[model samples]
Target: MKTNEEKKALVKQQYSELALSADELKGKCCCGTKPMSPAKKVFTIMSEDYSKLKGYEADADLGVGCGLPTEYAGIKEGDTVIDLGSGAGNDCFIARAETGESGRIIGIDFSPQMIERARKNATKRGYTNVVFIEGDIEEMPVPDNTADVVVSNCVLNLLPEKDKIFNEIYRVLKHGGHFCISDVVLNGMFPKEFTDNASMYAGCIASAIQKEDYLSEIKKANFEDIKIERTKTVVIPDDVLKEHLDEETIEKYKKGNVGIYSITVTGKRP
Candidate 1:
């Protein structure tokens, strides 16, 4: 088994490559990373539609998000918002629409390639208030009590030590400040091979924990008034399953109690 640092490095490397080719490959990728064979196109099962949202930028949309956290974020004008794993600034630009010109949006991402691409996108749009910083979410370089709100999209499950990450989120927000995050969670077990695959881990499937555990971590971070805003059952295509499991196992998995869900949850630091 890989160590925590090794897993982090693998995730970082995958995302770095994704930052370069996501736009060009478009629908060919799954969960924003893990490029499939060109002959077999992999549809994105995690991303929500962002094309119709206000302040939507086509170049900024990498088709990686599992849900639209901004839709349920309850952001107000002039509020400072921090987006964790803000890839290419998709959610940042959308939050900017709600926060308006007076508000500040800080996007923290560990991938330098993603940070550079996000900065370029911001510059292209002439947005001075939206800034992308390269840093680990588990140990953010931001100051305490620095944000009015926090938002993340399908990025937390990719990292180990989710408890530490949630604690960091709590530390960054002002008292009574809230957070909305969209992430993936599992309802049942997966085959050992599925969990062992590096590509599957970065694709946001194998790494996902139980839904109950995900919520427990949020509460453990001292967040209050936690609620699940939305939940959708994610259907992984059979072809994708074929990459990991044989026909018999796939058939059993399809008939079994297994379920993958994309959930958007909200909580506050109090």
Candidate 2:
């Protein structure tokens, strides 16, 4: 079994590769080795459509998000927003549209390649207020009470220690400030074999914890007015499950009450 640090390192390396290949695989989901046949959109189940949105930059969209956090973020013009795991500045750009020129947007990601790509995208759009910083979300470099709002999309589940990340999020936001996050959470635990795979961790599967535990962490952090904004069921097809599990494990999964869900949640930092 990989230690906490080892799991973090593995996630960083895989996401770095994803950022390096972002341009080539612009609209492709990073779930499987090969794209599932069109009949089965299993791998693409987590991603949402962003083409119609204003301030939508195709170059910045990596097609890895499970939900649209910005949609429920309640951002206002001239608010300072911080985006964790910004990934080529997808959510940052969308937040920019809402924040307008007076607002500031800071994107933090551990992947160097993702930071570089995000910075380039900001420059291309001539947005001086949008900035990308390379840093671990668990131990962000930003100051206390620095953000008016915090937003993240499909990134937190990749880490082994979610409590620390939530505490950090709380520390960074002002008293009335809130956060909106879209992330993957499981109804129950997967098999040990499935959870132990490093690639599955990066693909936002193995690293996910149960929904109840996930919500508990938020409450433990002293956040108030917590609410689940939206949820979408994600069904990984049988063919994709076969890649990781044997026939018996697959059958158990099918018969069990296990489910994967993309949930958008919000909470205020009191």
**TM-score of each model, paired residue for residue:** 0.93, 0.92
Runs in model 2 lying further than 4 Å from the true structure: 27-44
Which TM-score value belongs to model 2?
A: 0.92
Pairs of residues at least 3 apart in sequence or in different chains that clash in candidate 2: none
Candidate 1, 53-115: lDDT as tens digits: 999998888877899999999999999999999989999999999999999999999999999
lDDT of each: 0.88, 0.87
Top of the candidates by lDDT: 1
Residue-level lDDT tens digits of model 2 in 61-150: 877899989999999999999999998998999999999999999999999999999999999889999999999999999999999999
Per-residue error (Å), model 1, residue 107: 0.4
* CA lDDT for candidate 2: 0.87
